[model samples]
Target: MTKGLPMRRNTILLAIGVCAVFGAIGLFALHMSSTSVRASGLMPYQDARAIELGKTLYEEYCASCHSTNLEGEPNWRDRDDDGYLPAPPHDPSGHTWHHPDQQLFMITKYGTEKMVGDGYKSRMIGFKDSLSDTEILSALAYIKSTWPPGIIARHNKINGN
Candidate 1:
């Protein structure tokens, strides 16, 4: 047994302990992070700033089809010459409020063809390339923010409150 053998053992033990402590701290940091839009990784809509940015996105990308006032096309329910459905309103009167927030996010992110199926067709393309996930959520937030209190409450219930 060398005189330094005991010291080496203590040094190894201390290094291991430090590594363990750091690992535990990393896990705690991940757990403590609150940037998640929701528990399920969806968007949080109540932020006023996000809602404002969303309004801009809606005007630039969505207003063409869904209408500037969020009223949608005149014959939204009826199929056009190509038999594709028109963009529906985002207001409480429209079916957009009928779906949960996550579903809404998916539709906006992936577009109708991917979300609905191969057979479905629509002019509303996915904003995945043009906009970030945060932007999509922001636009959705603006849409939801415009709804009436009753509709908003109903949407909250749909989102599991």
Candidate 2:
């Protein structure tokens, strides 16, 4: 009976530990979601610190594929042999501005594969684990800050602002 009692106690402890792990994960996820994609959208573009941080992140994580000047790949509209589209420019000339702020956030955080859904392969891996939610927002804001005033206006309209 004592052996059975010990075994039951161990099982109870294990269950508590598992519950704690899941609870912590749930809290973290909630925090992440709250910090990202605010209802008003795109908070970092004009902020000096965010722009600077975004520039650093862009050069480090994005420049290799998107170009140092945000020019993207040569013939970016075309697909590679592996059937993935080359990275597109984030500048005014690019279609990046065509998408709304929330979409841009989702694509950056979740990557093209998950954003586009099933049967799709994407070279863009999600930055959710790699970059903080704040970093992701800053990067997007930096991209928008590069656009011309008229383009920015159009984008704002698309975002329903």
Candidate 3:
């Protein structure tokens, strides 16, 4: 009976290993399908030169509070006893990547107030009164270009085109 115990234990281990492998394979398959299609709908100025122009615009118009590298401010995730984040990072570590392009564009154009309802307020100034639509789109293009391939792929999937 003791000898048979060893065989039973081996069988249990094998089952667990097979389950783990199948779970891993399923996850990978989902990820692959999610990124299969790239976004086709895009801003007009999406070329390399536009991305460069966007970088300059970001530095000039967005750098003060958002930071030069879009890193935002110190303690960006922490509230100043007022329940507001200092300024979130534009990098992948922050929520910037999670938003779809249209939402980001709207936020830039109309400020957070238009999107988040009347009561909400943010330091972000609306570019609608100052920047043209083309310029705004270019700025977004530049930011997207900075993201890693995987992040971009995921964003494309989220856009569903």
lDDT of each: 0.73, 0.75, 0.67
Model 3 lDDT per residue over 1-101, tens place: 68899878867875674355334433433443433222344443348888998989988888878888888889774446764547767878766766656
- Residue-level error in angstroms, candidate 2, position 25: 26
lDDT of 1 by residue, 38-104 (tens): 4242445679999999999999999999999999988676568996767888887687876666666
Top model number, TM-score: 2
Error in Å for residue 95 of model 1:
0.4
Ranking of candidates on TM-score, top first: 2, 1, 3
* Candidate whose lDDT is highest: 2
How close is every model to the real structure, measured as TM-score? 0.73, 0.76, 0.69
lDDT of 1: 0.73
The predicted structure with the larger lDDT, 1 or 2, is 2
lDDT of 2: 0.75
Counting clashing residue pairs in each candidate, in order, gives: 0, 0, 1
The 10-residue segment of model 1 with minimum total lDDT is 21-30
Residue 24 deviation, candidate 2, in Å?
Answer: 31
